[model samples]
Target chain A: MAKSKKNPLRWVRLDNAAKIYPAAMRKNWSNIYRQSMTLYEEIDTVVLKSALEVTVKRFPSIAARLRRGAFWFYLQQVEAAPEIQEEKSHPLCYMSEKEMSKYAFRVIAYRNRIAVEFFHSLTDGTGALIFLKNLVAEYLEQKHNISIPFEQGIIDRRVPPKSEELEDSFLKYAGRVPASRRDTNAWRVPGEKEPEGFIHVTCFKADVDSAIALAHKYGCTLTVFFSAVMMQALMNYQKELNPNTAKHKPIKLLIPINLRTLFKSETLRNFAMFTVPEIDARLGEYSFEEICKAVYHKMGYELTQKHMSAVIAKNVNDEKNILLRLVPLPLKNIVMKAVFDRSGERKSCLSMSNLGVVRLPEIMQKYVSRVDFILGVQATAPYNCGFLSYNGKVYINLTRNIRDAGLERHFFEILRDMGLEVTVESNRN
Target chain B: MYCVKCGVKLEDTEKICPLCETEVYHPIVKQEQVPPNYPPDKRPPAKKKTKIINGVVLFLIFIPLLTSLISDLQPDGAINWFGYVAGALTLAYIAFGLPMWFKRPNPAIFVPCFFAATVAYLKYIDFVTDGDWFLSFAFPAAMYFCLIISTLATLLFYLKRGKLYIWGGFVIALGFFFPLIELLLSLTFDLRFIGWSAYPFVVFGLLGGVLIYLAANRFARDAVQRRLFF
Candidate 1:
């Protein structure tokens, strides 16, 4: 049935993974990520705005603003869609607290590209990609006067949103046993920070087939291959700073895993957790092959249905605690902030999020030239990497708040040495 | 084009390699007409509407000032007690509201102006009451308080390091200042020295000594920082 336009405003409690974002966020910094698609032609703002109005009606959970209650933070449906904005000089600008309360996500257009930046509290990468695909589908249909099929990640805007799509899947799938939340502190890359909170993003475009072949040669998936290379780069960079091997710390990378792939769920909210794969540098220096092997086995051991459920149970059970539920939101924020500072970004030197291959219908694919995924740097950590494969090419985006490009240089040099051709572009002058 | 240093392919829009900062130079192959990845127009986000809120606050403050003026003048043809209310309101606005007009109000400038206005307010009160205490008691007292506060504000605002030392010195100075205040009262009003300033002097002196010690010892500072790590 078609939903009434004047229906009462709906609100939902933040999902298990999302609850910490509101508390962990600062006045100038928030957990935000951007996904953009470049088309063959320039974008018309009027048509994009109208398309957003229609697309938002279909995704109630995504089209809402963050609100605070006495006990928890919730997402309330906005009366109208936020205005379409012009793209800034860079993607993922600092989203202040007031801006998040007004709108948790923004649609930006520049030249022939359309980008959507989302506050991580609103959704994970999978959910954000789905939202972006649907929005692009709507924009194409309106601008080109061609109907797009509701296949792949695109959704039908005419249909009402299903209850399952807005569900907190973690609450439903958590197991009885909670996982042990223990992790060792990792080595952090230190550098001079950019003044005035400027973020630098560098994107490397490579042939996906060749990269996949290299991964196959290493007997591992593309994510594991990249993780190993990242670890090696970090190790090399740290070794230069501290020549003594005995003083070295562990190198860890937090890889975010999409839970929908393991569990049977169709929700668009946050259903993702992370696994930290680390290497102890105190033992000895590792070769490229050794790092790859270690990362592959660690991913295999952690990315399991049983272990994922245990992690979910640990998070959900904390939310279910009666004493925790009764704590006021202000007090909860302080506790969560302290806990986050202690164990959140401290366990991982950086995050590597791979969205895998993105497939669009043939009709929709003709107009889209390329797609890019960019993750914002962590709260305390300086670097983050996000990548996605689309249309025979993989776009790997490295974002940092620091001025030194040693990590990027080392990373790309490794890929170049491996016989992979990388095309580099950046927002820097 | 390729980066001469890193050997990675560079886009036409890139003048330098993002990874290594190497200049891209190709004599035969000219730069293409392709647009850059991000937009050239780097528009910053709009600032908040602080001026509007400041204006609203100004209007709110004006309400009572005008009301008191009218109420004081209605009973007679001349301004009677309106000066006292106006002086207090003006002092309050100068201390609080004046800073709102600036985006980054410097304490070095505002602090002195606030204390000067405070002294003026006291002078006004003395003038209206026809008291003989303006030059000897009120002026010196206000100037002394102003000098201490102004120096503290200026030092704290300008100096980035040695905060603990500055605070320690400030507290110790404040401890001695109480006795001076008591001495002034005794000279002006012919009152006996009760030695009441000794209590505050003792407390502030001990606190200032500890702060200075912590400032000198790096180990103690680090320990305090770790324990109070928010």
Candidate 2:
């Protein structure tokens, strides 16, 4: 059935769940601290009344609520003082409005480059994507002469702020699901939460104009094809280290799928979950197209309504330690930890966030040299890849807790061999 | 990231240092919390004098525990229940004593587990040895202690860290319970169980040890880093 309402997007601020993850309020707070990094893109366009605006104006309350927290809060306020100590020269994200011009929206790039801060907290990528969309839409309407094309019956521009609910529809999907694989032995870690590092690299700018065509030629989106290549590269990396157990080793890649479309929520604290996709080293050694097809099929299965419900239900309820709410802080940590262990069902070896096809306005698209988003290297693994698309080009960034980075070359080599010319860049700090 | 623990330089070598780990020293006297790396606000008037005193006291305590471990390989008696007693007491002390060291604990679940585990240990040992008064009195006493330990531990953990605290307590009780329950049943029934059956108890102790160690070290390090307490 079609969603019951035209402005189906809704976001709810949970009173009970809001107090936790207080790290957001602490000093040196960035959305990235919670591992919640996002890019805010603005296209300064002479307002064109389009069908999309009609759909968006119907959802202003939804649009405005999205900017209330995290990256946007920092972006909109622009008064946050840097909390980093004077003695230290840490690369911190100080507020910047240098890009605001005769434009409809604000483009803020959040990069999670800190190597030591992954798995600190959970923020679903979908939540960030929705905020990005809302920020752009809101900026377009307010700053520029944009109007909703209500004649197209796109969406009713009639949402009163009072009518909106802060809660997300996908909240129903939250809970712990039965493990698909039983026994840690089958899972093959045997309770060894080992520290892993990555060899980080980049496949800098690929030909974005023909990205879809190249994808069709290779049988994948720029996301799946490259991710598959990443999978294969990781497998080779593992082989170089553990040659004896090469055949059965399952190379794991944490693939993040934005949940904005999956769950139409405008509230943007965290609304994304990732699918951990793994390929046997043999499967990893397959042709790029085959790996891409395999991943596409896997991701397709996960995003389905049936699978989304189960996954969402599992995550929320698994973290549903109500006792943590009622009990004192000292005593509550026990239950909180149980919640952590239960919710921490590792799906892959490293995190991969593909912010596919970043939109830019006509104005600032010129002087802006390039844009890149970063992912913090977490305990689950040594490195994670965060890539953003800007100005018809994609920038790949990797962060790791360990010093020597190795994912760049293998990633590019796989892409090159798969019939595509890709640019390369490295921030050798 | 400055030396929040002991004012020591932070680098690869100082990933997490020992002085910070134990938190025996603090340099500056600050209100509320200090930077983690800073040691206690004031060191003892004399360092070498204190270290020698601490070393002597530590050796005295270590000698007997070491001797008992080496001396009794199930010798001098039909059953070396002392091993069980010693282990239980240590668990109890760590669970209960350490937290009680402070009047107001930062995370308060530690004390009750000590008492409850101690009670369980005592009852388990008794039921195994005295076969005569096994259930009439022993089970109730042991279970009563278990209930208190579990309840207090659960309650305190919930208050401190929410659900995390409870999960931790459950793991602790479960870990210790493995050996205690089996030993109790074996004793009550007079079943001929081999030493191989007791292997799980070793695993339980190992798991218990690791959890306590990590929790203590992590807590201590965090406390130092936050400069919440000296």
For each candidate, what's the DockQ?
Answer: 0.30, 0.01
Report lDDT (Cα) of residue A18, candidate 2. Answer: 29
Q: State candidate 2's DockQ.
A: 0.01
Tell me the tens digit of each residue's lDDT in model 2 across A181-290.
32121122222121221122222566675555777786667777667777877765666555655345566666766665676554433455566666776443565566
Candidate 1 colliding pairs: none
How do the residues B118-146 of candidate 2 rate in per-residue lDDT, one tens digit apiece?
65665676666764544644565466555
The list of candidate 2 runs beyond 4 A from truth reads: A1-165, A172-203, A246-248, A282-285, A319-327, A330-346, A361-369, B1-230
**What interface Cα RMSD is found for model 2?**
16.3
Give residue A378's error in model 2 in angstroms: 1.5
lDDT of 1 at B214: 90
